[model samples]
Target: MSTALVLIMTPGLAFFYGGMVNKKNVISTMLQSIVCMVIITVLWGIFGFSLAFGESFHGFIGNPATYFMMKGMLGNATWKAAPTIPLLLFAMYQLKFAIITPALITGAFAERIRFNSYIIFLVLFSIFIFSPLAHCTWHPDGILAKLGVLDFAGGTVVHMSAGWAALASALYLKRRNEANHSPARITYVMIGTGLLWFGWFGFNAGSAFGANALAVTALATSTTASAAGGITWIFFDMLRGRKPSAMGTCIGAVVGLVAITPAAGFVTVPHSLAIGIISAVVSNLVVEWRTRTTIDDTLDVFPCHGVGGMVGMLLTGVFANQHVNAGNTTGNGLFFGETHLFLVQLLAMVGVSVFAFFGSLLLLKITDMISPLRVSAEDEELGLDISQHGEKL
Candidate 1:
């Protein structure tokens, strides 16, 4: 059920992003996200999962041989992370995580990238970038895990990495050519938002690995944070002299979900509320600020996910209560009378931001080499649905 719920998020994301782009590009934009379910799934089964969850290789990556072709995962085999479920089930669950991370990057370069080049990037990023980061942060013996970075559910690994990669992609791809641009369909965006919100409960709570109290708390915090975030973003819209909009409210709710992910298991309901509202306000400001800049982060993925992940990580260090989850090997946060965790979270965010940004930039270059990264100007004007796929509504 958890895996099924999370799988829905990628398609949800496709619609969310599809509706935000020009009508001519809608099909291509949605396909970019849906395609990850295909490419990343194959990659994960062969080696991506092993590189992330197999035997640790010096705290940076997994040994491909440890679970080659997912051997030893049948029958009574079990993983330490979730001893209650079969190892195979756990692998599928994590595969959903792997699938969505790259899909998120599509939003940054939706209309302009060559479809073939993006497919190549999907493979490369899963193997080289997302796998290693997942290893470092989630593996029990991984370096950052040993340093006590508290990512209950991939705040750093998923959202932060994707956010940084989105920024790198925007910088590399440059601006789109559209002179008069507006979303093609806000109704699609609203429906997509609802699907994303419904799936997120599983995304956060399912990270608990069992039907336990931690899962319950994660589910609770996720809901509270999203509500607070939506309200806060609308308030910001009003303060900025614009009417509160459905689109803005939807984006705010998703931002809250992103911000609460890393800390959901460690913080209380109230802390989640604070984290949501604070992140919404900040992301709203960043989106507004982006309009004056040259960096065309088409969907504002960096400001929302990247910044939200950073905020959640830092606040987790601030509001973490060992009483919520006694499993925290690291001491409590600054609010809990320990400054070490806060500093550690900051350092982890810096390291991840640098690695993801530079790594994605490099991958984009390599992908460009493999197949021209951007479409020709003629193709761009024709729209990707027509030019790339030979189809259009």
Candidate 2:
């Protein structure tokens, strides 16, 4: 059930992003998301899962051979971290995450990127960026795990990585020919928000790997943070003299979800509320700042996901309580007078931001060389739906 919940988020993302682009590009934008479900699944079943969760190769990545073609996943096999669930179930659940991470970046390059080039980048990112980060963050013997870093869900592995990649993509692709278009459908955005919010319960809580007090706490925190984020975003807008809008509310709610993800199982509900409020405000400000710049991140992915993920990670170091979950073997957060955990979180955040940002820029360059990353000017005016897919909305 949790796996299915997470899977729905990709289509939710499709509507969320598809609704925000020019009508001419709506189908193209949505298809960019839907394609990941098909592409990443085949990759995961082959060697993608192994590269993320198999025996670690010196704390960087898992050995691809460990689970090649799902070889050893049988009746009794189980992941050590999720011993109660079959290894196959664990692998499938993790695959949902891999599917969404690349899909999230589609918002940044929505109207402009070539479908084939985008496919190349998605495969590269899953194998090179997503796999190593997942292994280091979640695997028992991986580097960040050894360093006592905590990510209850995937602030670093999913949101932060996608956020940085979005930034890199915006820079690499430059800008759309017609960049000032209104959203194709605000109703679609509202519906997508509902689905994303609903699925996030599984995204955060299911990380606990079983029905337990920890999953309960994660679920509770995720709820409060998301609510706080939504209200705070609209209120913040009003404070700045802008009207409270549906778009602001939805974006805020999602930002809250992203911020709470890494801290859901580690912090109390009150702290989760604080995390949501802080993350929404920070992301909102960054979005405003981004618009003043020449960089064209079509959907503000970096400001919302990247900054929100970073805020959540840093605050986890500040508000995390070992009492919340015994997994906090590292120590209490800075709010509890301990400094070590906060320092560790800060170090990990810096390292991940650098790697994800720089590595993605390199991948974009390579993809561009293999095939043109953008469509021709004629296609730009005609719309990607008709030009690329031979279909229209």
Candidate 3:
């Protein structure tokens, strides 16, 4: 059920993103997300899962040969961390994550990218960026894990990396021909937000790997953080003399979800509330700041996902408690007067930000060379839905 929940988020993402694009480009934008479900699944079964969760190689990545072609996944096989479940179940659950990370970046390049080129970049990102990060952060023998960096879910592996890659994509792709357009469908955004919020319980709680107290704690934290985030966003807007909007509410809730992801299983509900509030404000400010710049991140992916992930990771180091989960061997957060965990989390954030940002820029360059990354001016004027897919809203 958890696996199914996570899988639904990709389609939810499609709707979320599709609703935000120009009406003429809505189909193309949504398809960019939907395609990942097919592409990443095939890759994961073949070797993508191995590269992320197989035997660690010098703490960098998993050896692709270790779980090649799902060779060793028998009925009794189990991942070390998730002993109660079959290895196949864990693999499938993780696969949902791989599908969405690339899909998330679609928002940045929405309506402007060539579908074939985007697919190329997605494959490259899944292998080079997403897989290594997942290995380093999650695998017991991987570098960040060994360094005692704690990511209950995928704050780093999913949000941070996707966020950075989104920035790189926006920069490389440059501005869309018509960058200013009203949303295609506000109702779709609301529906997508509902699905994402509902599915997120499984995304966070299921990380406990079993039906346990930790899972319950994670579920509660996720709920409060998201609620706090949604309300805070609208409140902030009203304070600035802007009307509270459904769009603001939806974006705020999602930001809260992203912010609480890392700390959900490691922090108290109150701290989760703090994380949600802090992240929503920070992301809201960043989104405003982004509009002042020449950077054309169409949907503010960097502001919401990237900055939200960073804030969550840092706060995890600030508020994490061993009493919350005996799994935090790195010691308590800075709020408890322990400096080691916070410093370690800080270092990991810097390293990951640099790696994800620069690595993605290189992949975009390569992908562009293989196939033109952007559509021609004629095609752009026609809208992606009609030009790219020969369809329209």
lDDT of all predictions: 0.91, 0.96, 0.94
Off by over 4 Å in 1: none
Model 2 Cα lDDT, one tens digit per residue, 242-287: 9999999999999999999999999999999999999999999999
Per-residue C-alpha lDDT of model 1 across residues 355-393, encoded as one tens digit per residue: 999999999999988899989888889999999999886
Q: What does candidate 3's lDDT look like per residue over 1-393, in tens digits? A: 889989999989999999998999999999999999999999999999999999999999999999999999986999998888999999999999999999999999887899999999999999999999999999998899999998999999999999999999999999987889899999999999998998898899989988999999999999999999999999999999999999999999999999999999999999999999999999999999999999999999999999999999999999999999998999999999999999999998999999999999999999999999999999999998988899987
What residue runs in model 2 are displaced by over 4 Å at the alpha carbon? none
What TM-score does model 1 achieve against the real structure?
Answer: 0.99
> Best candidate per lDDT, number?
2
* Residue 386, candidate 2: C-alpha displacement in angstroms: 0.8
Model 3 TM-score is 0.99
The global Cα lDDT (0 to 1) of model 2 is 0.96
- Model 1 lDDT, residue 290, Cα: 80
Q: Every model's Cα RMSD, please? A: 0.9, 0.6, 0.6
Rank by lDDT (best first): 2, 3, 1
lDDT of 1: 0.91
Q: Estimate each model's TM-score.
A: 0.99, 0.99, 0.99
Query: Relative to the unseen true structure, what is the C-alpha lDDT of residue 231 in candidate 1, on a scale of 0 to 100?
Result: 92
